[model samples]
Target: MNPIRRRPHIDYELDAGGRRSLWQTLPTLTPGLGVLRHYERRWLRLDGFAGIAVVAYMVPQVMAYTAIVNVPPVVGLWTALAACVVYAIIGGSRVLSVGPESTVALMAGAAIAPLAGGDPERAIVLSSALCLVVAGWCLLARLFRLGIIADLLSQPLLVGYLAGGAVLMVVGQLGRVTGTDVEGETIVAQLRSFFSVVGDTHLPTLAVAAGTLTLLLAIVILRPRWPGPLIAVAAATIAAVVLDLPAYGVAETGPVPVGLPLPHLPIISWADLQTLLLAGLGVAVVAYSDNTLIGRAFKPKTEPGEKSVPDVDPQQELVAMSGVHVAAGLFGGFPMSSSGSRTALAIASGARTQVYSLVAAVCIIAVLFFAGPLLEPLPSAALGAVVIYAASKLVSIPDIKRLARFRTSELVLAIVACLGTVLIGILAGVGIAIALSILEMVQRLARPHEGVLGRVEGIAGMHDVDDYDQATTLPGLVVYRYDAPLFFINVGDLRRRALLAVEKENEGDPDHPVRWFILNAEANVEIDISATDGLKALHDDLSERGIRFGLARVKQDLRTPLERAGLVELIGEDMMFPTLPVMEKAYLTWAAEQAVREQTALEHQAVPGADEPAGTPPARPVDTNESDR
Candidate 1:
């Protein structure tokens, strides 16, 4: 038999009926291997160009992010190496670039600061341990299919959180930018310290920072596709070396060790592990959110019917990220997240596959080995400038304005999250964001939008009466629709609104009060015990008022619970309908019978009696047992 060759773009990730053997599944799990196995020749040049662009953008940017991590600049290269290589190997997204991200770096630094007690060496160790713990968390989340956790941090919160982090970052760098040695852990205290030392600012460092920042901003505005930060950093480095800026009080990065560190487990105590657990989890959440967001944003576009790059799988992303962090930890690097700047650069440079990341990794390894001494003259102020420039992009003023205009309540949430992050801490801010999200959800469910439905003159079906001036309702019937599930917290609101609807109808026409009240229950997909009981009470109240109660479009999910709660039987099957039109037909028939009875009673009342002075009409006798034909 001839050996079968797998297609270059076949989707081996999807398992149908568990038919594929474990050996086949194992290779599919690592998507990078698939890319390598089917590597195309035409993509080499494109990926190579993209890889060079990534290297240009990353060398300075990742090193600058180390300021946020409070680690040595060399560690950033290690993080970049591990993140890119490992993520390329198993990552679901073809173009997502993972590295030392500002937000995650800030979080890791804050988490380890107290434990490290100002010791850089201890901070590195703690950061590495934290990375391992984060890896463990990612693996656990993947094992349990908890990828939905990424969505826990909503868009508004993200905007607010990043904005607040930006403020913290900019403030934190004021010392380095000015060479004034500002001292404080909090923003407010830092500002105080900064003002106190304002007079002591080193002119050389301040000038270097100003020049670099201006160049970066100008390049970003004028030529966004260029490696602005790299250009700025290289310019500053050249200026530093030529002018001997360090002799004039400009601090340099000093001597950086060349080459990569050997892979080994991060040494830490049990106490350290206990302390880092919560921080690690926080980092994991933030990192995963960032990774997923960037991955989605940069998902490669393919022609129709082409399967060159598979769609992003959130579960697979978690597994891939777990491996990335594991690699980072073993390489003695701090926690990392997807880098938007580098990924954007790669995309703009026309990257085709994970090979670009491999190319960038190879370049990073070379830089670490040979170019470490070249970075010795790199000014600290230049690095701070790079960080400030990156942080400035995170504010997103336009998004905040949009939120303010469209959704004021959500804007309030964004503001609260921002304040919490700024006033308390990043980790606390995450907690507040989650709490606000849950609270908003509960509040919405507790008092969801509801209205009396009626038919408009030209529109089909039913809509809210208040929404249309020409909408018409049945003479003595009210149809109410609630837009959320019927639960304990919200069942009371439903009952209240239903009763109010009836009262409104009666107030509008007392002579022919509401005779039927039908609940349009299509949106009420689930019902709890309390809600079922509340519904039963509502039925009894309507019956007492001589108003018939009916339900239309009740889902089976809700009906099962209603049946279990005895509400279905209490209301009776005759009063339940599969659709709104059928229920409306039943109500119309009942209304006609009611009208006939009312007319008969009125005619009999108007007839003269024998005891009255007026003449009586001839009586017609009716036999109870005989049939008249």
Candidate 2:
């Protein structure tokens, strides 16, 4: 036989009973590497075209965002380049473009300004350090699987934050747009200062800003997929150069340093770290929330049976973003997050993978080397126009209206968050948003909805008694459903509601008094010690009133806690049931026995000397085994 055929049959099957080694599982952890394994040549053209469009859009956009961060325009390009390359290598989202974002940029400026004391170089160093701190927070969040932290900001809160940031962006650029020195700390003061300087507005700068805004908006409306910002920037640069707009009081970017960025560690002391920790945490939360929202919105669509498509992983995103921030900090760049506009453009341009981000990064490096000087003649007023338009796009009136119509309270929360950002500061605004979200959650938990469950004539399962008029309750049973977790914060409310449910049943049907109370606990999956104590107290109170207490659909997770807390012994295992039907069967059998005992005592009372005591039977030992039957 041939040597290959003659070789003993090798057992290549994996060990069924053996555990997987960490080293063997390590490759599966980095999903981004898996994305690169199935690269298709046909996607290169689309990714290339998208990459060019993103670069064209991003160059001017980053330069515009630099104004918000109070950093030199060169810093923005470096950040975009570093973030894109790093995120492409590690990030989970295919189309999400990582770069300088308006909200985070504004937040970074606010955080670093006071510490830097008006020194641009110091500000840059502090900002980089802050980015590193944010990276630390992101890494910690990923390690702990705290991706749910993003849910702290509801959509309304996000809407409020973006709208507020947009207002601030527009207000902050008012001075540049009109060539006047308008200064203020708040929106009200800013508007006052803006009006005061209205008469002193430079006509050349105003004209440039107006023309740029109009052109950008028009292009966005007509051809959304086109590189409108690039076209507008080029047009403005040409106009400024040809007409000598600077001579007529139009400010220019002047000179932008060319070449690759030098890598350096952030020069921040331990004291600086102490001061920036809270601010860095704020930035991390805001950045992650914004990035998650954008990433989820633009996540790549999957075809039928497409095994290669990567799903959006929040924890992986945090890990990827941490890497991006670390890279940016090391490369002399400020903090960055996902840019919604750029990501949208990438998707619209037919981007298929993170390769588009890599391509964009290369293009930004090329611009740094070859096209830096060409940006010198770009008008500052035009850049302001670009920032204002980008900011304006973030304010969605339709979303606000929808919130107003559907959820008035959330609308109020959104408005409060927006006003806080505009009038106070970005950090304070975020704090307010977080506080409101927490308050909403607390209110919901504290006042959890409790319903009296009844069986409808034709319905398969029980429902809220108030929901259907034809629904009927059991003759001697009260089924109460508490639709929230039982915890310390709401234990008192749970007890109160249980008592109220009993009182209401007594008042409504005096003919057939409620003898059994059954708590439908499917929704109450979690319980705290306080809630367990409260449950025990409720059971005792029912026992004193001669009413039997039972639990339906009590999950095993909750049962373990109840058992640990000694609540299971007080309520008895026979009283706990796996489902409504089982509970009903046990309750009816017990109720029938109770009816027989009561009827026999009534007959004894009617017949003279039938019993030693009238209207009473000799007390028998409590039969715990009766419920099991």
Best by lDDT: 1
Question: What TM-score does candidate 1 get on C-alpha atoms?
Answer: 0.90
Error of 2 at 597 (Å): 1.6
Query: For model 2, how does the per-residue alpha-carbon lDDT over 1-629 read when each residue is reduced to its tens digit?
Result: 64655667788887433557998645535666777887889888889989999999998888888887777788899999999888887888888998898889988988887788757778889988988999999999987889988899988998998899898889889998999987666668879999998999999899999999999988889988778888898899999999998888799988889997678888788888898899998899999988888888786545588765555778888888799899988887888888877887887888889899899989999899999889999998898999998888889999999999997998998999999988888888989888889999989988989899988987899999899999987887899999999998998888888888888889888887778899999999999888898888888888777777878898999989988999878778888899898988888887788667667756755675555666555544344334333
Report the C-alpha displacement of residue 492, candidate 1, in angstroms.
Answer: 1.4
In terms of lDDT, model 1 sits at 0.87
Off by over 4 Å in 1: 1-28, 301-310, 597-629
> Candidate 2 overall Cα lDDT vs. reference?
0.86
Q: Which stretches of candidate 2 lie over 4 Å from their true place?
A: 1-29, 301-305, 609-629
**Count of clashes in candidate 1:** 0
Error of 2 at 390 (Å): 1.0
Please give the CA lDDT of all the candidate structures: 0.87, 0.86
Candidate 1 on 171-244: residue-level lDDT in tens? 88999999998877888898999999999999999999999999999998999888898899999999999999
Q: Report the alpha-carbon TM-score of model 2 versus the true structure.
A: 0.92
